[model samples]
Target: MTTTASNSLQNIVIYTNNKISLDFYKPFEDGLNPILFTVKTLEQIPRKTENKIHIVILESCDELSNLQINCNKIHLIMPAFLKNKLENDLHALIFKYEQSMNSQQALENLYHSFIKFYCSAEYYLDPQDFFNSDSYKDGYRCINIHEILQDNVSYEQQLHTYLNTISNTETVSFNFSIGYEFSSESGYLQLIENTVDHLTYAKDRDVFFSVVLSKHPLSDNRLAIVHLSQ
Candidate 1:
């Protein structure tokens, strides 16, 4: 594979401290020449002053907040759905994204951190293929659920709890909408106050995920696609 093989303008930066994982990224390096590196693997990262869209992937969830790096790296925690997908397919999709630079990870949606990761990977999956597999015979599930959340912290927390319970899963994602009326975080969360307990058990067999939010006294709807494998 060659960098010119796919004409994309995206700059992907992948960092990790694990050695065995380098082979997993060699394809990306040869295909896109992405800024792939581990702590001691590379001499140094690209200059912070470079004008480029940086997408960082962490192989391990090591807390990088304290690390002093010049580049304002946008670390996109890989979505659960992507961790186990066809490696070759994922590589090709990412290259296309670079060339187009068009995605659903907008600020208004606020999905850049997590959703971009999802879009760059799972968004390419055929929806028809996903809904048809009702059983976890393959040990994974592509969950698409829409729900309301009463609090930001609670919503994100419960989302993480499910991920933690899944097989080697660490990343979870969802969209949360707020009515134009709710001027405060507490108030926005209150909209889903009544459904908190039920949402905690979203994996139950009887729970049917919705593509649309339940219209009630709220104007904002939250969309969440939590890919968890119990």
Candidate 2:
């Protein structure tokens, strides 16, 4: 199918408890249109529609748990802490079926040294604008999740491109460092250990694949390495 024809068949439906102002998602309305719906109403929509639905859950509701198991179809957008907790709690059993193939290779590559930093609420709340700004891209290049969501492709395809970039890096050992005031190297190292453990198990999960550094907690000309892959 042509790119335009394929894009017309896909759209993002974000399910949330309360009705969020459409204005928040206004900028992303092009290409893959974004629509908001509550869990109750989401069920009411026809299941056999022409458009391929990409579900994004804003807040967890009990009714959505069954659908949540299919990570490809349903995406949960909770706080960074909550997502981390879920990754720690359920990652092992969730993808146990593929352990034999992925675990060993993933283990040997542990020394690659990667880190996924959680963006501050300020950045995530208006990710479109923050990602578009030159300030965040001053030190290094990044893949903007907001912009990718606006594209005519699936998140998985975009993720594949990102993983390929990591694999193609010239050096294996990468480090993520923040300014001294916000955290010490030891504290940051501990956080990285915990995050990598969860990440190692559920590497393909999109929620666990962020590299954006927090913009708040330090508002100066200080430079922080959000991600380092060489």
- Which candidate tops TM-score? 2
Model 2 regions lying over 4 Å from their true place: 1-9, 24-51, 60-72, 83-230
The lDDT per prediction is 0.32, 0.28
What does the lDDT come to for candidate 1? 0.32
- Model 2 residue 180 lDDT score: 35
| Model 2 C-alpha lDDT per residue in residues 1-230, reported as the tens digit of each score | 01111212223444444444333222231112223322333343334322333223333335334333322222233322222223222111111112232322321121111211212211112112212222222222222121222112353354345435442221122123233354555765564454344222223222222222323233321111122221
In model 2, state the lDDT of residue 59: 38
Model 1: pairs clashing at backbone N, Cα or C within 3 Å? 8-99, 150-189, 151-189, 174-224, 175-223
TM-score of each: 0.26, 0.27
TM-score of model number 1: 0.26
At residue 228, give the lDDT of candidate 1: 29
Best by lDDT: 1
For model 1, residues 74-94, the per-residue Cα lDDT tens digits are: 333333323333222111111
